[model samples]
Structures are given as C-alpha cells and as structure tokens.
Target: MAFHYPNGTPYNNHEAPKSKKQVKKQKSIQFGKRGMDFEEEINKSNAYYLSRNTAVIHKKPTPVQIVKVDYPSRSAAVIKEAYFRQASTTDYNGVYNGFYLDFEAKETKNKTSFPFKNFHQHQIDHIRQCLAQKGICFVLLWFSSLNRCFFFSGEALVTYWAEQETTGKKSLPLAIIEKNGIEIQIGIAPRIPYLDAVEQYIQSKKGVAMNDN
Candidate 1:
C-alpha cells in the first residue's frame, strides 16, 4: 500500500523533483541578522530544564521500520531502506513538577490566524487520553512573523476542532487565541520559555476553579 501523509496526501517517496528556476531563486535570496530557529531554541530550552533538574522533556524519536541494511564495515551498517511506521504523538513529553507534560510545538508565518491543519486527529486523540489520565497537554504555537508565541490548552484545541465538525471554522481566529491562550515571550540563550506559559496557564485554570467555588 502506498504511504499517505496525515492529510491523506500521497507520500512523495521519490526524491524531491529538481526545479532549476526554484534553485536559482533560492540562491538569490538575501541574508540578514539571523537567530536560532524556533525548534532549535525549544531544544536548547529543554536541555536547560534538564540540566537544572526542573523537567525531563525530550523529543520523541521517529519510529521507523528498517527494510534493508548493508554491512559496510566491521563497525558500520548503512540503513538502505526504511519508512516511518505511523503518525507520532506530541513532541516533548516528560514529568515536570510531578505533572505529566505533553505538547506539540509548531510555527507559522501567518500573523493573523493559526491554521488547524497543523494538528492531526491522532494527536488530538492522544492529548485526550493524556488529559483523561490527568496529564497537562497543550500546543506551543509560534507566530514567527510576529515573534509571538502562545501556549494553548489541549482542551481548548479539542473544543475548537470539534466545533469545526459543525461550525465549519477551519482556522482559529487570532483574537480568540489572544484571549484564551497564554502568551510566551521569546528569549535569548534558551529561546522559547514555554514552561513559563504553562505556569501561567496553570494559574489561570486554578483561578477559574477558585472563582467557580
């Protein structure tokens, strides 16, 4: 069976088609002041947390099925054929302050709204299961163009995603996220301090619970 991406798009197993025009345009792109990429920043932050014994979050390794391997040398083997097994759960999961933390990190160029397509049904289901076990589940969304980040609860994302099943809203509006999500400030050295956002989210939830009582 042909492999399919999460969106049902057939996997382009073949090497990406070469485009001479695209290559030329990419070569002409300008370079300027640069910073660590979003994912890298998050990785460094995770490292920092681990170093301090604050958290033990780590990115999950891609699950792959190896089909063929070549024994090139006594201590070397080359994986010739392999394929990813299936969609993955959220990235970066660990125990933090006695709480199970699980989250997916995503970055988008669009400054207005966050497209729901970034998330998959399997991931949503995983988050739901985690929540059922009393784990802290969320998504870390980065608006790169605007240099803004938000920690959105898995519960909120699930609610909106379910609404799409009936309301036909494909994307989450920026305004709603601004109100419901916890904004995270980007920093140097470690970069995205998402746990800070998580702390704020926890506080807000506690505040709501207190108000309800």
Candidate 2:
C-alpha cells in the first residue's frame, strides 16, 4: 500500500519494517519511541481534558519578531526572517476548577537527578508570583531515562532554586523529588494524569495548614 499527502505527493515508504529487536533497541535509547515529545504529550492531555469539559489549559505561544516575508503567491505569504523577542514565562496556563493553573513542562535525560540548569530564573520568579496570588502553579517533570514523571510544586522548586546559589547544589535529586513531589502515572486517555496529582497536592496542603492551626 502507498500513502500520499493531501497535496497528492506520494509518501516515501521504501524503508524496510523494523524488527522487534531493532524497535526495542530504539526504545531503549529514546525512552518510549512514541514519536511525540513530552510537550506534545502534555498538549494532547490538555486537549483531552478540554474535550471532556474537565479542564481548559493551553500552551503559551512564544513571541517572535518577524523581520522579512516573501509573498510567493496571491494567497500565500512566506516568512523569510524572524527572531524571538523575549523569553517565555511558562509553558501552560489556564483556569481549572476555579483555580488559576500555571505550569511548565520539562523533560530530562538524567536518571539520577534533574539538573537545575533546565529552569531559568525568570521562570522561577514568574511561578513564585503566581503562587503568591494563591494560584495553582507547578511543573511537570519527565524523567526520561527512568520512564517516570512527577508533579513538583513551584514553591518547593523555587526554594531549592534559591539554595542552589549558596549550597552549590546543581541538581534536584531523584530521591528527594520522589519523597516530596507527587508521582504521576502515565495513562492512555489523558497521557499524564497531572490534574489528579494537582488535586492530591491541594488536599495535602490543606491537611498541613490545618495541622499548623
């Protein structure tokens, strides 16, 4: 069988099908070999949530400065040059269950720890501000090498981030994260059922506050 693009171009299918061993080898090297990046998975999960009327979340678009454009035809124009004007604050944000949900999705290849360098100071500051406003802010971290994911609180992450300068610690240890963060189980429908973790986190915070009182 042959596949063709919508434009009537025949899709190339000359390569031989991969064997089981070959597929396994690739998966070992590339985590799941699911063909979609971590961010894409999160986007699909968000779409799924939206479709079910569960939550409304969306990825923030990066601001780019267009420098040049080429109009090859009357109906189409091509962007010839563009540059990013500034750094983005976070990846995803929206209102979920009357709470302002904001978060950044990130993946790491490291098996032992997630490096602090993966995050920027501006992002930390932005999340901190949101947290101060009592917004539900956190990060979805995918530990690719271990095929594990966790929902880390923005408050805890920022607190560790501040310690990085004085303590000289470079990374967040996996053990520490496993203990403090909420582990998210991978699933088919939602992909990463992070909202479940969010709910759990909210309950835990409430419990702690009540204990303090």
User: Each candidate's lDDT (Cα)?
Assistant: 0.75, 0.80
RMSD values for the candidates in order, in angstroms, are 9.1, 7.9
Please report how far candidate 2 places residue 91 from its true position, in Å. Answer: 0.9
Write candidate 1's Cα lDDT for 103-147 as tens digits. 987766777998887777888999999989988999988777777
Candidate 2 at residue 4, lDDT? 26
The reply for model 1, stretches above 4 Å from the true place, is: 1-36, 210-213
List, residue by residue over 76-95, the lDDT tens digit for candidate 2.
Answer: 99889986555547768998
| Top lDDT prediction, candidate number | 2
The alpha-carbon lDDT assigned to residue 133 of candidate 1 equals 93
**Each candidate: how many clashes?**
0, 0
Model 1 has an lDDT value of 0.75
